[model samples]
Target: MSEIIKIDSIDNNGRGVARRDGKAIFVDGAILNETVEANIYQKKDSFEVATATRIIKESSARVTPRCPNYGVCGGCSMQHIDPSTQVAVKQRTLEDNLWHIGKVEKAKVLPPIHGPYWGYRYRARLSVRYVRKKNDVLVGFREKKGRFVVEMDTCPVLAKRVSDLIPSLRACLNNLSCREDIPQIEVAVGEETVVLALRHMVPLSDEDTQKLLDFAKKHDIVWWTQSKGLDTLKPLLTNSSDSHKLYYDIPQFGLRMFYEPSDFTQVNPFINRTLIHRALNLLEIESSDRVADLFCGLGNFTLPLATMAKEVMGFEGSETLTERAMQGAKIHGLENKVSFTTLNLFDVDKEWLENLGFFDKMLLDPPRDGAFAVCKALTEMNPSLRPKRIVYVSCNPSTLARDVDVLVNSGSYKLLSAGVINMFPHTAHVESIAAFDLVC
Candidate 1:
């Protein structure tokens, strides 16, 4: 039976929310204020999952998805709505997470940091599958609800140069000697360089190497082959005259950042640049202030902070990343102004934090798990040792809410301002930043 339901709101995952029989019903593809005939597919104790069979009422914000494979491919969601409305949904998700999860009543909502929505994805791990039944090779993201690779000719979310190469990439792999042995491709795009790291289970035959070289020459893109692990990733033509490096440029800071293709970097370079600028502006670092950048991956934020602060210390869990961060600082002529250290940020306590000396300001760019230990330490440490202000960059809202709760409810801290960043515009990924000021 087709049950009619009205969407009360939208969730961060772009799902429509409604109430039925005293339980929350999350309807996929349904938007706010729209009534739809939904089918409940999965049931939980308090909530249920559904899909819209038909729209009794449609929202004006609905727009045709730009990508032909939008619904089938898992690369993007929310393409059914206008790009402007997509960001609005993200902002609402951030605020909702703060209130419902953190239990804080209100906060100053900062203007969202957003940029070019289309062709914005600069880095992606695409899946490769050789289907024996179909006698065809597929390349791109996986299916929305299955592990099978989606059939796609081009991807709109990738940089134009990278998107245009999907068909060619598939064709090249299909004719390879060990076509079935290849399982994945890592794509990285810099300001002027494009690196495609092909993960193959077997060694490439000489003919396969020549084919890859020809493909690289024809496309002006470099190739890296991996046999077992990321450690095995290396350029196909290491000694060739081609001397390009994979790096992105931040003209705002006059910094050219370099990284390995397998290293973690923001997928959307435009929004990343905007996010860094907005984060630093919100940090309000002064010349005399000593700042610490927590989870500083390759000095993306530390070097920029060094340019403004008297001294900056960056801490990361990976020695490789810390070494790269130090090199970046040295090459940028900010070695004297900044330093990088390797430490397990997750295991830190109040005393450990206190041992690091006083930091006038602090910035955190943690992974999806959020900075639990650091926030807890701030609440437990001497108020004199706590930084006066903090600016946190988070990719997950639930963890951010959980950590924010620890800081505001237990810690002597005031939630000053918080807002969302449209880092992944079409998808439900919420990249947000929050500010806190220690209570005097």
Candidate 2:
């Protein structure tokens, strides 16, 4: 029998750690400062896997999860813990990763960026399955450890408007001729509009199309259909030009960016705005300075930076996204100040860096893979062209820490400040921003 130990604290991954017989046992559904009886499932030499069987003593941070399937649905992990505590845990996780893994400490820890805990998720990919045995269609996120879709009538994390339409969507799909053919639905909610991207393995009949159109008209939602790859996505009806765009206005910068449903966008628009404001503040660009916005998706930061800088050069891997960014700049009449180029950032070279010319300030918002090659290339560039200041927006803590190490130890950049952004409230995903300044 595996001995149970009191969980001392929560780890970066949201698991609670307890020591039993000199071995670290990780228990799920256990909170910090709580005594829980856990049942060990997997026993390893140095570590063990366990699930909380009973809560002997509860932590003050523990709260009743809003969703009945909170523990079973993989969509959220920290819902059982208070929202305030969730943010605190994430902030500490960011600091611990930076200090222990990166071997570098930030000069300052900025206050964490947080927003509405519930009804905050504006984007989600919901799995769809038709369970004939249950005489119903299962939609929403998958069950925590199970492959079966959670029979969710509504999702609390989804925007209130979108959450209310979940049942209607399920009913509409359930009645379609090719109900079983539909595998998933992608939800993208913007300031004024909501788009649903239906991924179908088979073609929809005329009746099915009309049913979808009727549903769209009834709910005042936009319907987009994807038969295959991303490029194959198209509107179900011909008069959806206005409905297809997801719009958000950045009043602070006097800018608005429109995007398609399938495009990459911040799930939480509120926090996104906050993050952009913070990054711009950290850059503290002078009117004479030129900035480079690497991995600039649809000019999310590039256009805002352009308003303050003399010139802003944006680089992205997708030609489609680059063209969209260019269009956005033109729409906002900032094209004169903003320029964009399409290049694979993962394999950036010294030649590419030199071709881009000199930049005083840099903003890198790379994906989870991190911008190792881009950072390395910048470090190897001619001294005259190397950016003096850099702001890195990262979605993964470990990679951020690793890249921070490279910048601090080898690239002669001093860590300025680092902090977490609670973009996804209930999940373990961590979004962080760090600033670095070149040391003369």
Candidate 3:
């Protein structure tokens, strides 16, 4: 049945939420304060999922999406919503998660951090599919709610240079002798370089290599071929030169950190720099203060912390990342002040926390799974050993909420402030940061 419902607010997944017979109904492609005609497809005892058939009333926050494949492509969901309103919705989602799931109240809500709505994604893993029937190569993200690749001519969310290279990349791959063997491309854009790491199931022939070389020379990109795994990725058309190097700099801290194309780096460099600045500010690091950056990938936060603190120690699960972090420290002339160690943060226990010693401040930037183990370990530690302040940068709200609950309720910490960061604009991915202080 077609039901007309008023969208009261947006859910965390960028779906419009309404109520039908006291049960919450989620409608896709609807906006807040708008009345949408939706067809309920999946009905549960407590809620229903629907797709909006038509909009009887449109919201003022609705805007025309720039990408033609907005709804069809699974890369972005909130493209139809205005940038400011998108951030607002994300902030609300963060707040709701903290309150409802974490059972913690923040004294203040930090204003959402946002940047360019388009062309902000610096890194992306794109799928490659050679459609036999279509006699064409498909290179882009997956189709909405399906495993099929979305045949995209351009992707505006990627760096403009990379976005413009999609059609040419598709053509180059299609022309390759082993086109069917190529399955994926990892696009990484640095401050001064662009790298495309192509994953191949079979060895490239001499002709395929030459084609890749020609494409690299034509487009001015460094190509890497991965035969098996990330460790197998090697330079295709370029040597170990400045042109092939991938690095981003923090002029404010006089630091430039380098990493391999497969290393974990923030998708949005603009928001990343801002997040580092905000984290440092919240840390209030003194010249004599020692800081610990857990789950620190390639010293994204450690090197900057070292700039103001006496000593900074970064710990990560991957030894490769730790090695890169140490190299970053050395390049920035912080080798003596910053140290990197390999530790499985997800498997952290109270004994491990005790062995790490004390720090004046701590910063943790974990993946979408969050840092539940470390928080639990912190809760078990003595009050005096706990860091004075803790800043957590999280990519998932649900996991962030669960970890925050452990910190505030059980770890004897107070949630001073928390807010959302729009790292992936036009998408439902919620990147957020929170500050916690030891309860007196």
Candidate 4:
């Protein structure tokens, strides 16, 4: 049975929200403020999930999706909406989260930061499978709401080089004896080179290695084989110097960062640069200021802060990342100005926070979980130990909202400004930055 419902808004996952019998129905492929004919697929206690069978009335913000696989591919959800309006939706989502979840109003809304909508994903993990029934190898992201991979010849979201190689990759994998053994491919793009790490459950034969080398030479793709874990990854084609390392540069700060393929780096390099610039501007750093960067991965923000401030302390829970950050600092000749420390910010308390010494400012770039423990510690610290200004970069808005609530309600801080960064355009993921000022 088909039912018509008016989409009231969109959810965090980009699904449209509609009310039916006092229950919230999440409809796939429906735009906000538009009426859709949907067929319910799954029913839950409080809400039901449906797929829009037909668009009875379309939204003014709706636009034709560029990718043919947009509806089925799990890579993107908001591609159907206009690129500019997509950022608007994300901004509204962030504001709504702050007001509803944090129970506080933002003193100022910073303009959204955005970049290209296509070919912006420099990092991606694609699923691979040899389908005997289809007599071909499928390589791409998974289908929407399915375990099977979406068979795509190209991905518009990926860099043109990576996207253009999808078919060739499938052909190469199909010819390999260990095709069935390969389960995943990690794509990491740098300014000068692209690396593809193939995860194989079984070891590749000598003949397979030669075939990979040939493919590498032919397509100019750096091939890496991972038999077990990330640590086991090695270049299939020896003497591939480009595959030995990957790095990006912050030209504004004259800094370069090198990282291993498996390390965590932002998928969008343009947004990352802009994000760093915005964060530094908001921190109001001075030459005499001593800044701490919590959860700093690979010295993304720490290195830049070190260049601007007298001394910067970078703390991360992962010892591997801390070591990498230190190396980056040394490479940039900022080792004396910046220090990397292995500390678990998640488990921080008043004693640990106070022991870390004083800082004039802080930059926190935590994972989706947010820095609740650290924020709580900040609230409990003596006024003298607290940093005057804090800039937080969050990947998840709900967690950010929750943490900001604690910061404002308990930490004696005021929410100065907040805004969204379109880090992953055409997706519902919102990367945001917020500034907080300590109350005197």
Candidate 5:
């Protein structure tokens, strides 16, 4: 039996922290201000892994999760913790990583940005499996710490309308003649419609096609089928009135952007708008200033920045993404103000930066790999075209801190201000935005 320790706080990964025998211990399913007896699962050189056996005392922030299969489903981790407290923990996580990892401090810690806590997931990739023993079909996210998909009848994190279709989806698949042929279902909700992209290993029979068409008509859903890669997806019905395009509207900017199901997009639309506004505000764009948006995906930030700046250049690795961005610019009547290029950012060169010309402001929204190569190339560029101000938005803190070290120590940029955005409420994933200014 592991020694019972009172959990003093929670870590960035949603684990409870406690001290046992002068050593740090991480307990799962235990929250802050909770005194619980734990069973040690594994022991490492410096720390121990445990699971709470009994909760002698519970924290005030603890709440009964809404989902029946809360712990088993991998979709949500912080559902047990209060929603307001979830934002506070993410804010502290950003501050701690900045001070501890980068050895830097922010001039100001902006208040954390938050939005709807439940039913905010507008995008999801759900797995589909056929259980031979039960002679039934199961579809949803994978189980926590397991390889099998959880048997979820409903998902509370999905939009209410989407959640309501779970049972019908299961029944629809079970009744199909190609029941075992289907592999997965991708759900994406747009401004006016919901798209279900079904992945199948074999072609659907005529009867199966009729069933799918009946289901689509009865539920008022658009059905798309994919037999091979993403490019193989096509509509099953000929007379369906659903638009093939998926789009979301940004009322604040009067912008409606269209994207494909496989394309990258902000998971939470509400928080994404807020993040774009905050990042632009921190950049302090001027009418005469030119800006560059790196790793620009579907022009999420590029289009908005173009509205305020004199000229904006967006760079993306995929030519398809650049093409979509160009289309968006044309639709918004800002094509003259914005120009997009396709370049491999991982292998950037000084000459590439030179060709792009001078920019006064920059925004970096790279993936989890971070932008080390691009950062190095920018710092090595001639001093004449170096951007004066930059705003970095990242999903990983460790990589963000490492990149900040390079920019602060080797480059001319200095960390100005940084804060967190609770884009995902119940998960351990943290999204942050930071500002840097040239220290000439």
Candidate 6:
């Protein structure tokens, strides 16, 4: 059955939202204000999910999707809309999350930060599958509707080198004796090299290892293999040097950040640089000020803070990340000005925060869970002990709002400003930054 509905808004998942007889319906492939004929796929008590089969009236913002696998692949959702409009939807999503979830409003709104429209993704986890029925291997993102890998040759949003390697990669892996046992491939493109970590469930034969090495050499790429877990991910060849190491540079800060294949790094390099710059500007770090960077992954923000502040203390849950952060500081000759502590930030309380002493300013770059425990602790700690200013970099709007709620409503902090960062364009991933200042 088909129903013609007018889209009212775009949901957090980038689906077009419509109302029919007081019930909400979410339509895929439909844009706001567009009248579309949709086929209902999933139905719940309060809302129904549908896929737009025909557009009766099209939105001006809608554009022809570039990728052939646009609707089929699960990698991106908003490619049908214009790029600028994509950023706008994301910005509105951030604002709505703040108002509805946090029950607070920002005193100011920062302009959305964005970069290139395509070929910006520097990291990806491509799925691998060997189908006995087809007698061939499939490599790419999962299909939108199921666990099957997308039958795609290239991904436009991914880094060009890595995107171009897809076809050859599949052919090379399919030739391997253990192709059926290979499950996934991690793509990490750095300024100097492209690293691919192949995770296999079984051991690779000598022929398979030689084939990977030959492929790496032919493509001028490095191959890392994982037999079981992250601990097993290492260079396929033991003789590889620092030149083969994966790293990206922040030319603005004169810093180079290095990480392993399994570590987390922003997929978009351009916006990551600008976001860091915008965050530091909001921090207003003085030469005499001492700063704290919570959940600082590999000192992405902490080292930059050190460049402007008297001293900076970094904290993370994993000791390995903290160790990497310190090494990065030392490489930049910032060892004297920065320190790191490893503790589970999720488990912190008021007493623990108070013991850390007073910091003139603080930066929180937490994961999707947001800095809830830390924000709660800030509210309970002595007013004098709390930082005067804070800059939060978040990837999830809902959790950011939840943590920001504790900071603004429960704590003495005021929501100074907040805005979205189009870090992952054409996708529903909403990256945002917010600022706060002590009010009491």
Residue-by-residue lDDT tens digits, candidate 4, 1-440: 57889999888778889887789999988988999999998899999999999999999988899998989998899988887878888898899989889988756999999898899999999999999999899999999889989989999999999999999999999999999989999999988778899899998899998988898889877887789877798777667676656889999999889987788999999999999999999999999999999999999999999998999999999898999999999988998999988977899898888988899999999999999999998999887999999999999999999999999988489999999999999999998999999985
Question: Which model is ahead, 3 or 6, in terms of lDDT?
Answer: 6
Q: For candidate 6, what is the TM-score?
A: 0.98
TM-score of 5: 0.96
Residue-pair clashes, model 6: 0
* Residue runs of model 1 more than 4 Å from their true location after superposition: 240-244
Q: What are the RMSD figures for all models against the true structure?
A: 1.5, 1.3, 1.5, 1.3, 1.7, 1.1
Which residue segments of model 4 deviate by more than 4 Å? 237-239
In the range 316-404, model 5's lDDT, one tens digit per residue, is: 99888999999999999999999999988888877888788889999999998888887777777887888899899999887888788
Best by TM-score: 6
Model 1, 330: alpha-carbon shift in Å? 1.3
Instruction: Estimate every model's Cα lDDT from 0 to 1.
Output: 0.90, 0.88, 0.90, 0.91, 0.87, 0.91
RMSD of 6: 1.1
Q: Candidate 5: misplaced stretches above 4 Å? A: 1-3, 238-241
Tens-digit lDDT track for model 2 on 144-176? Answer: 887999988888899988889988888999999
**How much does candidate 3 score in TM-score?**
0.97
Task: Give the deviation of candidate 3 from the true structure as CA RMSD.
Answer: 1.5
Q: What digit string (tens of lDDT, one per residue) describes model 1 on residues 184-231?
A: 999999888889999999989999999999999999999988999778
TM-score of 4: 0.97
Task: For residue 97, give model 1's deviation from the true position in Å.
Answer: 1.9
Q: Clashing residue pairs in candidate 5, if any?
A: none
In model 1, the worst 10-residue window by lDDT is: 240-249
